[model samples]
Target: MTDKERLLQYCLRQGDTHIIFGYRLGEWCSKAHILEEDIALTNIALDHMGLGNAWLERAASVDSEKRSPDDLAYRRNEREYYNLLLAEQPNGNYANTIARQFLFDVYSVLYYSELLNSADDTLAGIAGKGLKEVRYHYKHSAQWVVRLGDGTVESHKKIQEAIDDMWRFTEELFEMDETDDIIAKSGVGVDVSGLKEAWKTQVSEVLEKATLSLPDHNLSRTGSKTGVHTEHLGHILAEMQYLPRAYPDAQW
Candidate 1:
């Protein structure tokens, strides 16, 4: 593929993760245990949605197919999506959601730190803004991880369990393929593999503060980067794309 196509694909992959994770976070809008958290999560979800759109718009600019941002986001099939499987998993409980957020936030911090200096001006600009928002997101979510994990015996057990359940998906975030290879070589994309060690250190510090133990299991399930995902993604698309699919070109 050409460099243009590679960049577009890379941007789309980033957008996909943001959009799907934003949607999952939105699921907790009214369901959070407290009103303060309810509003906080909703706002964070919106931030993610906005960030995702920015990347998608950039993707549209480079797309030879000339697909619009909305078209790329709402009209894509499961086989075409490149989001991490972790983003698509159901928000089982507050603790489960926090576990997912903490894991991704840690990775996002390290990912964007390098991305801020990317050779591609547009991607670098997006990373510049994204870094600020994700830093707040990481701090917000990390505190909760500590609270729930170190609070009570019951809370501790539940949060630890959530960590274990989500552990298998974490490795997928750092798996690099050809798309990443090209971008990294050109200094326009991050080498995800390099982020692994730092990500682990950051996560370990937070987990220690939370009094949570890392899962003994090292087995990680992947494939979302290759358009392979868990069953949950289909349901997400079904609900998320309903209006766009049912009313093509229709707008209120």
Candidate 2:
């Protein structure tokens, strides 16, 4: 494929990833155990949505015939989405949710940091703006991870279980495919493979600080990057696309 095509596809994937994850996280706006955390999670979720909008707008510019950002995000089938599986996983307990966020935030910051220097001007600019937000997200989520990991015996146990349960999904965050290869060679997309070591180091440091143990299990389930997601994504998309699908052309 051509460079333009590669760039647009990369942007679409990034947009889909963020939009779906943001919509999921937004469900916790007023449901968090602590009011402060509720507001904080929603604020971060808004950041994700904002980033997704920016990337989707850029993607739409490249392929106007496909659909607008609204349609791309709200109208796509479950198998068409390119988001990682971890993002679609249910927000089981607070600890599990936090663990998921922490892991994603780490990868996002690193991904955007490198994307800031992309050859594609729009992609680079978007990454430049997103890097700041992701950095803060990492900090906020990391703090929570530490808090829960080291809090009390019960809290510690719960958070540790969350870490173990979610750890397997982390592998997909750094798995690269043919699309990634093309975009990375063109200097438009961050190389997920290269970011693995850095992500692991950062995660290890944070877990150490949290007094949490690393999972001895190394086996990881994969495939979401290629659109083979778990059963969870269907439900997530069902709820997320409900209004848009039911209303058809309705506008806000």
Candidate 3:
């Protein structure tokens, strides 16, 4: 692939992760345990959508076919998407949702912070705008993790289970490939592998404060960036793309 192709794919991967993750958060719109939490999750979801759109638009800017962000988001099948495996997993419960958000939030802060100095001006500008929100997102999710993990017996058990289950997927957040290599060489992308240890340290500190154990597993799930994914992504796409696919020419 050409350099622009690599950059396009890199942007698409980022766009996919945030859009899918944001949609997952949107699922909790009216289902949250309380009203205040409901608004908080909704606002976070909106932030994800905004950030995802920016990345997708970045990809569009580099596309040979001149695709729009909406086209990239809604016209693609599951195999065309590059979101992390963790983003597509079901939000089983409040704790599950929070656990997923906490893990992603931590990674976002680290990843975006690195992007702040990206050689690509559009990407650096996007990072500068989004990093503020991501830091707040990290704080919000981390606090909840501490609260639920250290709360009553039942709450603690649920949050701990959520943490353990989600830990394996965390590995993919730092996976690096040639697209990363090519882009990073050109100073436009991050070698996320370098971010793994810091991710773990930040995660480990939060888990400790929450009285939760950091999962130690030999196995890790991966490959979504290269179009591989679990079954859940199909379901997410079915719902997210249904309207746009069904009404291809409809205008807002």
Candidate 4:
């Protein structure tokens, strides 16, 4: 309701998306077809975890109660999470994972780069570190998208299918609402809606090189802005938060 409340929500939304997507990347550990890629995904996953935690810590700092970052992440129910719908989608296959990663990486690179100018110093600092990390992430995923998309026919088909599957969720990345309205007015938020055209152009160029067709859909997956999410988020939270919830007093 208040500006501070909206900023806290903004931080939480960004934090949730990063943490959830980091966990998704972690799912590839020991599961990637190649060992090098397995390590790469894990490292990226860790980077995401750090980035996520930074935002969560900032969110906690903003909270009147001064909650811990873990308290926010490990204690919240699915409905309380505000991650992008794209971030929480399942990793169906290597192609599927790459497709998902490619899309998000592009957006992440653009998103964080712009956030470098945020009016809030802490958020800008987070963006500075996050920008360096995701730029590498984008390069990695973008190359894979091209390699698979332009490779064998089977590879192309699978990658294309993955793209189509993930395309429906892409729109959620740029949706502006009360949170953005509040935060952007304070100059603490990047106006993501303004990034859509650039995102589309960069995406189109990559798809062109990959020989992949751009997917056009009349509808997109939505609801993340309002704490609405797909069913997968519940399952992810069940595993991720199980330890904290089960052993609230346990000290490791």
User: What do the candidate models score in CA lDDT, each in turn?
Assistant: 0.93, 0.87, 0.92, 0.93
Candidate 2 yields a Cα-based lDDT of: 0.87
Give Cα distance to truth, residue 17, candidate 1, Å.
Answer: 0.1
Pitting candidate 2 against candidate 3, the one with the higher TM-score is: 3
Candidate 4's residue-wise lDDT over 1-252, tens digit each? 877788899999999999999999999998999999999999999999999999999999889878899999999999999999988899898999999999999999999988999999999999999999999999999999999999999999999999999999989888999779768877899889989999999999999999999987756979988888999999999999999999998677
Candidate 4 off by > 4 Å: none
Q: What local lDDT does model 3 show for residue 100?
A: 93
Candidate 1 lDDT for residue 19 = 98
- Give the Cα-based TM-score of candidate 1 against the true structure: 0.98
Residue range 49-149, candidate 2, lDDT tens digits: 99999998887787746678887788789887877788888888899889999999999999998998998898889988999999999999899899998
lDDT (0-100) at residue 125 of candidate 4? 99
Model 1 scores a C-alpha lDDT of: 0.93
| Candidate 3 ranges beyond 4 A from true positions | none
List the RMSD of every prediction in angstroms.
0.8, 1.3, 0.8, 0.8
- Extract clashing residue pairs from model 3: none
Show the lowest summed lDDT stretch of 10 residues, model 4: 216-225
Q: Who is ahead in lDDT, 2 or 3?
A: 3
List, residue by residue over 164-209, the lDDT tens digit for candidate 1: 9999999998999998899999999999999999999888899999
Clashes of each: 0, 0, 0, 0
